[model samples]
Target: MSLRDTFRRDQVFAPLRPGTRPVRPGQLDTGGKHILYMEDITVSFDGFKALNDLTLYIKPGELRCIIGPNGAGKSTLMDVITGKTRPDTGSCFFGQTMDLTRMTETEIATAGIGRKFQKPTVFPEHTALENLELAMAGPKGTWQALLQPVTGQQYDWMAQTLETVGLLAQKDQLAGALSHGQKQWLEIAMVLMQKPRLLLVDEPIAGMTRQEVERTAELLQSLAGEHSVMVVEHDMEFIRSIANTVTVLHQGSVLAEGKMQDVQNDPKVIEVYLGETG
Candidate 1:
């Protein structure tokens, strides 16, 4: 059966696993609104401003698409969210009380924020199942985690995750032998293993075949209702296929945002980005 067929038959998308560690007072409190809040964010390099007073908000379980031309601060915006680049000014919060600017990258990830870069990164020497095993979030170090045997429950969860990503059939295959698209799916599966509340995916379909791109769109769409997903992509067609709300970035700030059609029709968006790419 096809991936879409399987998804329809099983409805097998797993619920996001909650953080295993103890929660601090107000750690994830969002006042029942947005899961992410970035207000007046600014970042600069040398003399050039990579991000300037950019404000964005992501509600719980939202799938938001970000599109822009080169040097529009798409990458820098992601860097700020993942704690890779500290902004010169702004208040970034995960939920309501978790101050992202005050946290480390590791801390941010552990707090249920996961990022998947453009390139697929997987353990080539290991089987698909083994890669997920290594990626399972826990207090154990890498070597220590590898040493411990997979429990029956853990194994079942891993199997389910593979199925969710349409990779159950390739579970025993070496990751290196998988196709490029499959490798991308494997990396996504690895991130899913961490059970993040918000997922950041950068250019997910960059080198994918048409068929692969379709599958990727379906995969990302299916993930939305349970985990907030932010996708930064250049392909207008792919974005149109998956986007409900699109945000266009220009010169380090949001130029336009709304339904895809509205954003497409925006005069500013056309002048800055769509005219060239659309």
Candidate 2:
């Protein structure tokens, strides 16, 4: 029988293990509105507070942006969420049940949260398609994937992801040969292959051209409602371009939470973040 004749979207795309399924966000029950829940979380370094009593909640499939000045704890917040750093105190949960503080970084990733940092990391010698295939291999071991034949479904899925990230034309090109913006998109496509439910992106547009930034905004906005996305950025225009809701952080705590317009108009934001009144 042909593979398509027997393919199942709701079933595991590969036989990696029992209960493994193609990453389809919202397919699994989150059991609550928030995909991430944090309360009174704090972190300190040598008598300095990185995150101070920060309480935050994100609903399933919401695209939220976080902005703050230096030491406002933007990156630190992501570190805590991704389990890279432990908080000094407070509770953090993934989907209302998984205690994030209790899980290792690998475990947190397995639980369906993926993080992308400012720098794009890809195999320089590898083709764009090759980089994505490595991501699909997951814990199965790259050598094992190399030994096993690629399934038709996996090819289709990789192709779809490449198209989604607008890298189809460069599919066979060396990842290193691509432009900076293309590298960033390629990195994001790799993240998608893992089928993460919550995506944490940091400073995604720092070095992109105007066109690249707009395309990225479109891509990130499109991701909302399919996967919950949280972005940490300093570019107010980019934040205004895509974020439906923005959270302003100051001194490791939330200073304001509202639409981009409202936050942009706030006097505190003018004095501290934008550097001028609008």
Candidate 3:
């Protein structure tokens, strides 16, 4: 048989490994409280502390915002959570059972944590639907995935996910042809295909138009009760629009954390970040 024919047969006949499946929220052991915990986490580089004895907790289904000036270790914090960087000291946990520090990046993602960076990384040449298909939770290689047909159930779920992100109407549109904001939403939809329990978004509104910003805000708000949404943003106004609780980072530690109004009014926050922004 030819290589293409072999792959086509394998698509239907190959047995999937149990371990390759993405972990569902129902499978997580969070003890009905915090979905994530970072205790006394610290990371250092060349005598510089990127993160210094920081502790944070994220409750299940909560929308939390993180704010800070440049070099405040915001990226490093996400890095640690995503398993890109291993902290020199401290513990990071997903739910009550999973130790984040002990997991690999791929392992963490498969375990239900998804991250969307500032730049949209969709497949520009593919339609939005195709992008999600490629991102579906499975162990297939890209080529194998393209050759495999999506099951009816998977297609229905993908459509629902597109609707959730407000991109169902644009499912057939090429990712490269979509607006910047649409592309961002498309990337989010792609992540949703993995059914993550915790979503870490970085600078979601960086280049969005005002209307796109509003829509994005609404989408994020709608997602909170179902998935724990953690946003890291520099736009204070945007933060105020969606944040119920905001955490401020300075010098690689949590400088302040509370309601948006209170955090904004904090003298320490003003002295370090808000004053500079103003």
- TM-scores for all candidates: the values are 0.90, 0.88, 0.90
Off by over 4 Å in 2: 1-29, 276-278
lDDT of 1: 0.87
TM-score of 1: 0.90
Q: lDDT of each prediction vs. the true structure?
A: 0.87, 0.84, 0.88
lDDT of 3 at 188: 95
Q: Which residue pairs overlap in candidate 3's backbone? A: none
Residues 1-278 of candidate 1 have per-residue lDDT tens digits of 74323322123233311222245853676453578877789999997999988888788998999999999999999899999999999878787567789889989998889999999999999899999999999767767877899999999999999998999999999999999999999999999999999999999998899999999999999999899999999999999999999989999998988999999999999998999995
Model 2 per-residue lDDT tens digits across residues 1-278: 53322322122244321123233542444654467777788999999999999988788999999998888999999999989999999878776457789889998888789998899999888899888888883697766765667789998999999999899999999999999999999999999888899999999987899999999999999989999999998888888899899999999998888888898888898888877412
User: What's the candidate order when arranged by decreasing TM-score?
Assistant: 1, 3, 2
Residue pairs with clashing backbones, model 1: none
Give Cα distance to truth, residue 140, candidate 2, Å: 3.4
Model 3 TM-score (2 dp):
0.90
Which of candidates 2 and 3 reaches a greater TM-score? 3
- Tens-place lDDT digits, model 3, residues 25-133: 4266665347887878999999899999998878899999999999999999999999999999987878756778888999999989999999999999989999999
